[model samples]
Target: MKQWLRFLGPLAILAIAAFLLRDKMPFLAEGYQQVLDANNVGLVLALIVTIGSMFAMAEVMRLLLMAGGTKVSLWKTAELTFVANAWSSTFPGGAAISTVYQYQTMRKWDVSVIVSSWFIVVSGVLSTLWLVGLGIVSILFLGASFSIWPLLGSATVMLGIAVLVYLATTHPKATSRIICSEVRTFNRLMRRDPERWIPAIRKHVRQLHAVHLPRRRFALIAALSLANWMLEILGLWLCIWAVTGALPGLERVGENPSFLGVILAFVTAKIVGTAQVTPAGLGPVEAAMTASLVAVGMTASSAFGAVFVYRILAFALMTILGWIIYLISVARGGMKAGEQS
Candidate 1:
């Protein structure tokens, strides 16, 4: 049943994408061609920046784990991280895939599951905050408009900050509360005899609370996380620069609420071909983005060239790189195969 769902999910997503794009596809096709034609060798430079900065994300993870007293080397940890990354960007439920795979990989390196979860959770929370910032920046500079979803983005950041404080200061107790609230029912359903699950959970929670991170390490983690965020945004900025000679300011970029609205609509497009799933966010991103542009008092097609090129660099190109890294890991037996565990 699980296997069946996995297969169906992508198919379902693609089918929906096709239905959405049945109308303005020619324009989408034209946009894609325009993007490709506008590309220059400089994109490879952006790719290099993206790839290098992306790898730096691994360093951030390593520092988090180290703070918890797990002594894994940075380079060794990054190798396994590569595979974890590959799965997440390319697969549905990829987040879970990366989580479980990273835990298993770390175990091979003699890292405990508790420590592994800490590293994973920390990296994710920090990374998410960064993503929110990037999203905001993207909007600010976007030649399109996005919905003024109240303080939705701000709320998300604040909640994440609260969670981080909880994790850093009063972790075990807070984490347990969150888990119980979120997953208590799932726990009951998974077993013949439902267990409170607190004692076991508390064990890890206590470990988290007890773990001491030095001030230097904490600062390092914060810095690296910030760097990771800036690098990717810089990559996006560079991509736009490539297509258009000048940069669009924050107000200009944040012009697309429609783009924002339709993102979740076709987000699952990766599995479906662009025609079906619109992997490039082809028609879906464009239409939504165009609507967003109009919302911000911008003109559609006036910046069509910039929008298309930006998507190519930000989404399509990075995903392609992710796939390449995945394939390399698979062929090498395993990322950790030859290395000492």
Candidate 2:
């Protein structure tokens, strides 16, 4: 049964994605047709930029692993990051699956469970923090006089990140105490003995503190994460330019969906899509992005076209590549090599 599920789960996810994307099929076709007709150079640039984001993400993972006392090659880390991200974006409960896969893969490399878990947890938090940072920057660049809501949302995001970073870094012991106590409470409610798990939790917390990243490492991770997001946004920009026949620049501000406006729209749509109610945030993301573009003065057709192109290149293409790499590596005794990574 487990084997069947493991095989069928991805197929099921793909089926669902197809079902959800049916409405956008026409737009996707049109988008591709437009690109071909225009013979746009921007599309190629966009692809390169989007692919670069994956490399940047891999670096972030490699650095985190190194901090945990394991040194993995850049290519190996990149492969794992790509596969894990693809799995997370493709399946229901993908985030959990991705975490488990990453943990197991790292364990194969002889990384301790505690370090693996820490990397997973800390990296997730850091990534989210940077995403929030991007959203906030977008809101700011779009100008506060434009919308009160996004400004407020950005402020809230900033505050949340500050609190989380503070708790995780400056107050690790206190944070651990709170988590341990909460676990004990939950265990009591479930009629399970808290003693069995409490000690383990404390030990893990101590290990996390011992391996806590220094300021320089933290800055490097933040920069890489931010660059990854920026590259993705740039890809969206190039897509819009490919369809509209005008590459909007930051200096060309003054309304009518300027470059900053497009970026703001992209950031807004991404936040909405982060809910991930659909696989890889497909339906909600497209809808949000299309709406945002139209609101910023793009024609509905152009908005849809640009968004479809960006999604195809950034999300779908990456997933396909990741799957290919995963399959090839698995056949090449990659599981054992993962440890040496």
Candidate 3:
């Protein structure tokens, strides 16, 4: 079961993606029919944003991986991260595959799992905090009309990260002890391999000064992450515009308050639903998305179309790209060699 995490992880993410999509396409198609203006410029711009966001996201992941000492190239790191990301959205368990893959990628580059895992966790957590923190700010400052719930919601997310990071960094040994003591089977194995995780976590806590977060570079990554989310959200907004043809009230983006909610729902569903072993978030995430859209004040049909477009843009395309990259690595006949990378 533990070993299967590699393969099953991707499957789980895909499952959620699929679950959320149930019976949504038809309704979305109908919505598209209703609003057929197809402003070539808006759509083209949206596409450009989508591609830029993907690459920007790649940089964020690369930094995290490199922090672990994997020393992977930007392009190579980006490819794996993008593929794994698409996989993660579908299968709940897919994160494990992505995790193991990250370790493998770093091992190829002569990095330790200890460094890789800690780096991945740190960067992933920090990046998320930044995104959620920004969302909260936008809601509070720019999104004045949005419900306080959304604003509060964003603040809470960052707060959660702050607490976790403090606990993990301040007390790696105690925390590691807890996991060792409480997790039973899992704890024993991890403890057995000190180099794999424990030491790095302890070091992360003790030597905080060494992990210098360069201000200019850090700011760029944070900005890129923010842009990634913002552009992705805008893409969904444009899809809605394409379907409705009527410009949703200017306030809709800020006033409706759900621009964040929909993104939240999609990411949440993608993350949580990946637990399933399905091919992609085929069922769980789709269902979650629809429910989430309704909560944010969108008509069911409109929400359906918006989600449909998002899935195609974020998932379908990503899967193809991921597979292509995976295949290329295989064809290069360097799977083992690359794993060291």
Q: How close is candidate 2 to the true structure, as a TM-score?
A: 0.78
Candidates in order, TM-scores: namely 0.63, 0.78, 0.64
Write candidate 2's Cα lDDT for 241-274 as tens digits: 8777777776544323777677777777877766
On the 0 to 100 scale, the lDDT of residue 34 in model 1 is 48
Alpha carbon lDDT of each predicted model: 0.55, 0.74, 0.58
User: Largest lDDT belongs to which candidate?
Assistant: 2
- For candidate 2, the per-residue lDDT at 195 reads 67
Which 10 residues in a row give candidate 2 its minimum summed lDDT?
2-11
Ordered from best to worst lDDT, the candidate numbers read 2, 3, 1
- Candidate 1 global Cα RMSD: 7.3
What does each candidate score in C-alpha RMSD? 7.3, 5.1, 7.5
| Candidate 1 residue lDDT tens string, 1-341 | 45335434554664476447746755444444445665475466666766666667877867666666666666666666655655554554466666888788777766666777767766766665554554555455543344535325654765676467546454567677777665667766776334567577666666776456677876787678778656654554455455544344533345322333222212222213223232233455545545443444433443454555555555556665555666676797655622224
lDDT of 1: 0.55
Tens-digit lDDT track of model 3 for 204-310 = 44443223345576567667667777777667666656544544443445324245555655555544454665545555666677666666567766666556665
Error of 3 at 335 (Å): 6.9
